[model samples]
Target: MATSRALAQAPPAPARRGQHPGIALTVIAATQLMVVLDITIVNIALPHIQQALNFNTTDLSWVINAYTLTFGGLLLLGGRTGDILGRRRVFIAGVLVFALASLLAGVAQSSAWLLAARSLQGLGGAIASPTALALIATNFREGPERNRAFGVFSAVAGAGGAIGLLLGGMLTSWLSWRWVFFVNVPIGIAIALLAPLYINESERHPGRFDLVGAFTATVGMVSLVFGFIRAAEHGWTDSVTLLSFSLAVVLLAAFVLNERRAPQPITPLHLLRDRNRSGAYGLMLCVAAAMFSIFFFVTLFVQDILGFSPLRAGFAFLPISVAIIAAAQFAARNQVRYGPKPFLVTGSLLVLGGVVWAAQTGITTTYVGGVLGPTLLFGLGMGSIFVPVMLTAVSHVAPHETGAATGMLNTTQQVGGSLGLSILVTVYGTASRNEARQQLGAFLHQATPQQLVEFRATGRLPAPYSSQVLVHGISSAFQMGLVFAALAVLIAVFVIKVRPAPAPVSPSGEGA
Candidate 1:
C-alpha cells in the first residue's frame, strides 16, 4: 500500500523543450520502428535462411516463433521493470542487448545459434517497446502535442510490417539475408547513444520485482504460443501439442493466482477492470490477428504464387504502408473531435471488407484487381484503427500504470499475430489437403492406367493445377481473417464507450 501510494504520487519528468525535444522524439520513434518491424523483417529472409542453415521446413518456423514467443511473453515483466527501475536505464540496456543479439544472429552458423540469438532479440524488444511508449506519455503533455506524437508512433506501428516486407526484400536481394539482422546493429547503437542525451528518465517506483509472477506468465505464454505453432505443423491431437496446451493452461492459472497475491505484480490486474480499456485491448488483439494474416498470406501469394522477385515483393507492400501513414495522420488530427467510436467501427468494417474481397483471389487474378485493391482498403482501415485503439488503451489510466497498460496492449498484438497465423496455417493445411484430394480423385477418374502410373511416379501436379490449390488455401485463410475483423467490429460497437477528450487550454487559460 505504501508502494502503491508512492507510485501514484510520483511525478512525470518534465518535457524537454525546442530542438532537443524533436531529437528525443526521433530517438524514441526510431527505437519503436526497429522493435516493431523486427517481428516481420526476418520473414522475407526465411527461405534464404532455411537454405543456408540446412533447415527442414518444420524447423524454419522456429526462427520466427522463437522471437515472437519471448517478446510477447516477457513484455509485462519489461514494463514493470521500467516502472521499478529508471525507464532510461532499462531502455538503454534493452537497445544494447538488441544490438548485441543482432550481431550474434548475423554471424550465427547453425540453426540453434540463430534461434538463441533471436530469442535474445525478442527479450531486448520486450524491454524496449513498452518503455518507449511509456516515454511518450512521460515526455509529452496529454493533448494535441501528445496526440501528434502518438500519431507518428502509431503510424510507424501500423506500417512497420509492410515496411519490413520492403526492407527485407531489398536487403535479401542486394546483400545476403544475414544483412536483415545485421541492419539492426547500427540503428540500435545509434538509439542507445542518442537516448541519454535527449530522452529524460522517468521517476522510479520503490518496489520488489515480481519474479515469480514474471516467471509463470512468461512460461505460460511461451507454452501457449508453442502449442499453437505445433498445432499448425502437426495435427491438433498430437501428444506434444496436447501436452503444450495442457501445460500452458496450468502455468497461466498459476500466473493469475500469483498476480493476485504479489505485492508488486508484473501485471496490475486493475488495468483490465475498466470496460473501455479492456475493449481497446480486445479490439487490438482481433485487429492484429487479422492484420498479421494479411501480411503472411499476401507475402506468400505475391512471392511464391506470382513469382515476384524479392525486390518486387517488397515494393508490393509500399501502397499499404503509404495508406496507413496517411490514415493515421488523419486520425491524429480528427479523433479528438469525433471521438474514437466512429473511427473504430468504420475502420473495422473496412478491414472486414478488404479481407473478404481478398478471399476472391484466384490463380488467374491480376495484382491490380486481386491484391492491390484489397491492400489499399486494409491499409486505410488499419491506419484508422491503430491510432484510436492506442488512445483508448491508455485512456483514463493512472500515471503509474502507463507502462503496464501499453505493455499489455503490445503483448496482445504480438500474441494475437502468433496465434492468428497459427490458426490460419491450420486452416490452410486442412483446406489444401481436402482440395488436393478432390483434385486427385478427378484426375484419377480421367487418366488411363498408364497415365496414372506416370502421375503416381512423378507425384506432381502440372502448372496451374498446383497454383490453383495453393491459392485456394490462401483464400481460405483470408476468409478466416474476415472472422477476426468482424469480431473486432463487434467489440468496437458493443464494448468500447469513451467520451471525447476535452480541448487543451492555452497559456491564456482559454481552450485552444
Candidate 2:
C-alpha cells in the first residue's frame, strides 16, 4: 500500500543535480525512440519478408499485426506490472526480451518462426514502453524540466514512423530485409546495459495485480482487431467476418462488465468517468485511425503507382517528420497558455484539410503539388494535437494511476489505429473495385484477351480514362480520412473541456 501511495505521490526531487539528469534523459529518450520506431519499422520490409518466407498475402499482415495487437492489448498489464515490480527492473528485462526476439525474427527461416518472434517482441515492447515513460515521469519534476523532456519524447514519438520507413528501406535495399530486425539487437543491448546504471528504480506497489481485467481486455482487443482485419480482406458479409465480429462483441462486452467488478482494475473504470479524459481518448482514436490508414495506403500508392524506389519513398516522408517535430515543440510550449482545446480544434481542422488535399491527388499530380502539402499539414496538425491531448489525459489523474492513464492513452491510439485502418481498408476495396468495374464496363462485352489483361493490370480502363478512376479510388479513401479528422475537431471543441490557464515551462529548458 505504501508503494501504491508512493505512485500516487508526485515524483521525488532530482538526486545529485548537474549533468547526470541530461545523461539520464538522453538514454531514456533513445530507448523510447527504438520502441516507437518498431511500430512501423517492419512495414517497408513486409513485401521482402513475404518473398523471403513465401507467406500468403493474408498472413503477411499478421507479421505487423501480431506485434501491434499484443503491444496494445498488454499495455495496461505492463504498466501495472511496473507499479508492482520496479520500473527499472521491468524496463531492463523488457529491453533484453525485445532484443532476443529481434534476433529470433532476424534469423527466422519460416513465416511461423518470424510471427512467433514478432509476438515476443510485442510483449517485450508492451512491458518496456510504459515503464520507460513512467520512469521519465518519476525521474523528472512536472515543470520546465519534465516539459522539455516530454518535448524530446514527443519528437521521437512523432518521428519514429519516418525513421522506421527509412531504416526499413535501407535494410531491405542494401542488405536483407531481416537486417531491419537485426539492427535492433545491438541498440537494445546498449540501452539495456545503461538502464540500470543511469535510471533509478521506482518504488514498487505491493497491492494486488489486476489479472482478470488484464486477461479480458487483452483477449477482447485482440479478437476485435482480428475480426476487423479479417473483414477488410474478406467481404464484410463472409461467415468468418460475421463470426469474428460476434466474438469481438461478446468478449469486449465481457471485458467491460468484468472491469466494473475487478478490484484495482488494469484500466480503472474511473478514468473513463472523466469527460475530458474520455474526449482525449476519442480524439486519439479518430485521429490515429485516419493518420495510420493514410500511411498504409500512401505506401502502396508511391510504390505501385509512382514507382518510387524504397529509399526514395522512405525519404519522401522526411518533410512530414520535420513538420511534426517542429509543430509538437511549439504546441508543448504553448499548450498551457492556449489550453488544449484550441490546439486540438485547430490541429484536427488542419488534419481534415490535409486529408482533403490528399483526396485530390492523381497519378499525374507531382509529389510536390499532390502529397507534400497535405503531408505537411497532417504532420503539423498531429504534432500539435498529440502533445496537448496526452498532457490533458494525465493532468488530472492521481500519481499511482499515471501508468494506467498513460497506458489508456496509448491503448486508444494503437487499437484505434489498427481497428480504424482495417475498417478503411474496406472503404478502399469498395472504391477501387467500383472504379475498376466502371472502367471495364464496356470492355467486358467487346474486350480482346490482351485488352482485358491490360485492364486487369491497371485495375481500371486503359490510358487517360484509367488514371481518372484510379485516382478517384485513392481520393475516395483520403476523403474518408478527411471526414474522420473533421469529426475529431468537432469532438475536441464540443466534448473536451479544460479550464484555461497560463502555459507552464517545459520540463526541459529548451522550451523555456
Candidate 3:
C-alpha cells in the first residue's frame, strides 16, 4: 500500500526562471527519439544491411542486438555518472559520443565495423537517455505541468520505434541505408547544442559507484543472449553454445552474489521486494520481448513476402504508432481511477489476440488480412501498459534510490527486448532452416540448371519458395510471442496489486 502512494504525486520541484522550458522539453524528447529509434531504425534496413555486409541470417540480428545490449547493460552506470558529474555536461558529452558513433556506423565498410559502431552508439544512448529524464526535473516544476511534459515525452519515446521503421524506409528507399545513421547525427548535434542553453544543471549527488556489479550484470546478460542466438545458428548441443550458456550461468550467479554485498548495488535487490513493483518488472520484460516480433519479423514479411517496397513497408507500420499514442493517452488519464489491473489485463489480452492473429501469417496472407489487425492490437496493448507499469515501478521507491529504480526500469525494458528477440530469432532460424530443407526436396523436382547451381552455392531457394520459408519462420516466431503475452496477462492479474489512488483531500483536510 505504501508503494502505491509514490505515484500519488511528486512535490513541486524548485522553479527556476529564465530557462526555455518548451525548448528544454523539445530537446529531451528529441534526444529520447534519437536514442530509442536507433533500436528499431535498423529493422527496415536489415535486408539491405544483410546484403551489403554479406551477413548470414542469424548474424543479421546483431546489428540491432549490438546497440541494445550495451545500451541496456550500461544504463545504471550512465544514470549514476550523471548523478556524480553534472547532468548537463554529461548529457552534452553523451550527445557528442552518439553523434560520432552514428557517423562511424553510417560509413561502415564491413560487418565488424558496423557492429562495433552500433555498440558504441548504444553506449552513447545509455549515457544520454536516463540523464535526459533527470534533466526534466531541472527544467520543469513537478505537478500538472510536469505530468503533461512526461505525457508528451512518453508519446515520443513509445512511438519512436514505429517512427524509425517509417524513417528507415524512406532513407533506405531513396538514399541509402547509411542515411538512417546519418539522420541521427544532425538530431544529436541539435540536442547537444540546445540542452545547455535551455536546461539547468542538477547539483552533483555524491554516490558510490558499483562498477563491479554493473560489469558482471551486463556481461552475464550478454552471455545469456549470446548463448540463445548461438544455439539458434548452431544446435543447442553445439560446443560453443554449451560454453556460452555455461559461462552465462556462472557470471550471472556471480552478479547476484556481488549485488547482495555491494556497498551500493547498481540494481538494489531490495527494489524487487515489493510484489507490485516486481510484477511490473516481470510483465515489462515479457511485454517488451513479445513486442519485438512485430518490428523484426513482421517487417521482414511485408518486404520479403508481400512485395511491399521498403518505404511502403515503413508506412504500413504508421497505424501502430497512432494506435499506441491514442491508447496510451487514454490509459494515462484513467489508470488512477480504475487501478492498473483492468488496463494490464485488457492490454495483455489485446497483445495475446494480436500475436495469435499474426502467427497465422502465411505466404498467401496479405497485409490487410494479416498484418494490420495484429500490429494495431499489439500497439494498443503496449500503450495500455506503458504508463501504469512505469508509475508502478517508482511507486514505493526511496528518494535516494529513485535513480537506481528508474535506471532498472529502462534497463529491464531494453534488455528484455534483446533477450526476447534472441529467443524469437532462435525460433525463426530453426523453423526457417527446417522449411528450407522441406522446400529443397520439392525444388529439385522443378530445378533448372541455374537454380540448381544457385541452391548448391547458397543453399537458399529463389523467389516464391524463399518467401514461403520466411513466412513459416515468422509464423513460428509469433507463436512464441503468444507465450510472452500470456505471461504478461498472468502476472498482471495474479501478481500485481494497486489500490486506486487515495481520495484527494479537500481544503478542510477531509477526503474529497
Candidates' TM-scores? 0.94, 0.91, 0.90
TM-score for candidate 1: 0.94
Q: Which of the two candidates, 1 or 3, achieves a greater TM-score against the reference?
A: 1
* C-alpha RMSD in Å of predicted model 1 compared with the true structure: 3.0
Q: Which candidate should be chosen as best, given TM-score against the real structure?
A: 1
Q: For model 3, what is the error of residue 280's alpha carbon versus the real structure, in angstroms, after optimal superposition?
A: 1.3
Which ranges of candidate 3 are over 4 A from the true structure? 1-20, 50-59, 137-143, 445-458, 506-512
| TM-score-sorted candidate list, best first | 1, 2, 3
Clashing pairs in 1: none
Q: Which ten residues in a row have the lowest lDDT in candidate 3?
A: 4-13
Q: In model 1, what is the error at residue 191, expressed in angstroms?
A: 0.5
lDDT of 1 by residue, 1-512 (tens): 56654543476444344448788889998898998888889999999999999999998989998898899888888888888776777788898999999999999999999999999999999999999989888778787788888889999988988999899999999999999999999999999888877788787776777888878888887888788778766879999999999999999999999989988788889898999999999999999899988899999999889899888999999999999999999998887798888889889988988898898988887788899999999999999988889889998887777888999999999888888888888889878888888777777777778876877899976555678789989999999988899999999999998878777778999988
Model 2 misplaced stretches (Cα beyond 4 Å): 1-19, 442-470, 500-512
lDDT tens digits by residue: candidate 2, 9-51: 4353233433377777777778777877888889888888989
Clashes of 3: 0
- What stretches of model 1 exceed 4 Å from their correct place? 1-19, 446-458, 507-509
